[model samples]
Target: MTATASRHRLTTAKAMVDGIAAEMERDESVIVLGEDVGAYGGIFSSSTGLLDRFGATRVIDTPISETAFIGLGIGAAVEGLRPIVELMFVDFFGVCMDQIYNHMAKISYESGGNVKVPMVLTTAVGGGYSDGAQHSQCLWGTFAHLPGMKVVVPSNPYDAKGLMISAIRDDSPVVYMFHKGVLGLPWMAKNPRSVDEVPDEPFTVPIGKARVARAGSDVTVVTVSLSVHHALDVADRLATEGVDVEVLDLRSLVPLDREAILTSVAKTGRLVVVDEDYLSYGLSGEVVATVTDVDPGLLRAKVARVAVPDVPIPYAHALEYAVLPRPERIEAAIRAVVGA
Candidate 1:
């Protein structure tokens, strides 16, 4: 099949917003709604110029009521519109949990397949930007626990664009999480042959399909979001010491690529899960449980999890850094797994 080929230099945030705008233009049913999404063009400039392009009817700016706007988005989806609602920051999802978890997610199942809520909820997640506890949070784990929602966390510009497009077109409620830290990095924009080969035309990376970003056999490192980059960095460092580690980026968390996790564990015989969420009942715990339950003999060493402590995020930069997982922590975990 022939593929669309185009190249552009843009930040991860810009690419994602641009992809959303493109999809909106292609589909008349698609609309954007959130505080400052129209006139202000979003708090992070992710939606700049959208209001001017799509006009106020499509690019709506709502009051500072997340619960109300999210519910409106859900109701709109139930009708015919494919609304893309921005929650500003994922931490603020608490105010709209009823709409997201109970209403939109359960509507189809609760109605015995009579209704389908095809909407995308985009939010900023992760720490390191000094946004304090309310703004800087990696709450993908919260939505992952929900039954019907698909959770996606893109690690780079390419994945960000493709995954956002996929989320927009998906027939179920999808939470598209963009990490605040990697939005403008030059490395994320690098045209690595692997990702540069991504189709220029709009396409979807199937949800729940994990990508082995870097392959090796000594140990398997499963992570997502900012942790994916950290794991890759640690893998590179370990390679210099003759320790081979395979890095799996679990781009979508809810429909987790369980087969990929099991296969990688079987090959490496050791596993380490790095997540930005807290240690208790988080992504790390879920991954370890899944691997151990599938094949106890596949693990040569006890599975290790590098995660944040089970505590509220501190406001101090030093304390925040100490709480979140880092490359050093991932490197240590890899070394421990490989007996290096």
Candidate 2:
């Protein structure tokens, strides 16, 4: 069935689970392993209903041991099984860094291309819910920094499902980062775009491709995940004021879509990178570098960045909002770049 024919809308989290379930039905080798993924259906509901749909063998829950379960997923991938491992929170990667960076991300290269670690490390990211420093973080930069792993972050339900299918099908390890604020949870504050229409059938959104969420000529706002929503909100508000702003969502990070970023900047001649990740050594820097590397002359205005400062995320609600790249902060950055 075509996506248009599917009149119903789906949340980003539900779309993710639907995509994984479709893959499991086609391939019995695909399994899910993570804490609460079975019964609880993932802390953020990324795997909701998977356990009952696929049974315990396929959607197996494990003890609160990130290292053991993550390492097990790596080994299983080497043995020709596609394992979808959930890390719960992106900030919890400290507990199993070796298993991810060293093993799941490098086994194929270390094995002289003889071994393929076809696994998906899905996790939740962002800090709008006051999840605190330990539970709130967007560390896609760390995984994208390392080689042999593909990073995919979806801003909407359609991309979420398509990217999940692609990640499950890819031969290399894929890190799927979803922002908690985009999951469409009733308890949390979220954008209306979070519960948009999604295709009923499984599809693939190619890795490394950036999507133009909104088109404009005055300025380009390059971002991903939850920040995409924020940028779009700002763009819409600015459009009414006659300040045209483009919102570019870098759905996949590891492949790093240089062409899309360059194409957008080439048109606008002004850039503003908004990211939930830290200000230094992350997507914002990399995006600015991508432009300068091609041609500094293409840039008409100095690049502006709106990102979290180089500090641990605070636990207080006010502090968290103060640091995150909200719509007001994004609008300000766009104005600075556009001289509006």
Taking the tens digit of each residue's C-alpha lDDT, what string does model 1 give over 96-124? Answer: 88989999889989999889999999898
Clashes of each: 0, 0
Candidate 2's TM-score reads 0.98
Assess the local accuracy of residue 75 in candidate 1 as a C-alpha lDDT between 0 and 100: 93
Positional deviation of residue 323's Cα in model 1 after best superposition, in angstroms? 1.2
Q: Estimate each model's TM-score.
A: 0.93, 0.98
So what's the TM-score on candidate 1? 0.93
lDDT of 2 by residue, 143-202 (tens): 899998999999999899999999999999999999999989877888999998887777
Evaluate all candidate structures by whole-model CA lDDT and list the values in order: 0.84, 0.92
Clashing pairs in 1: none
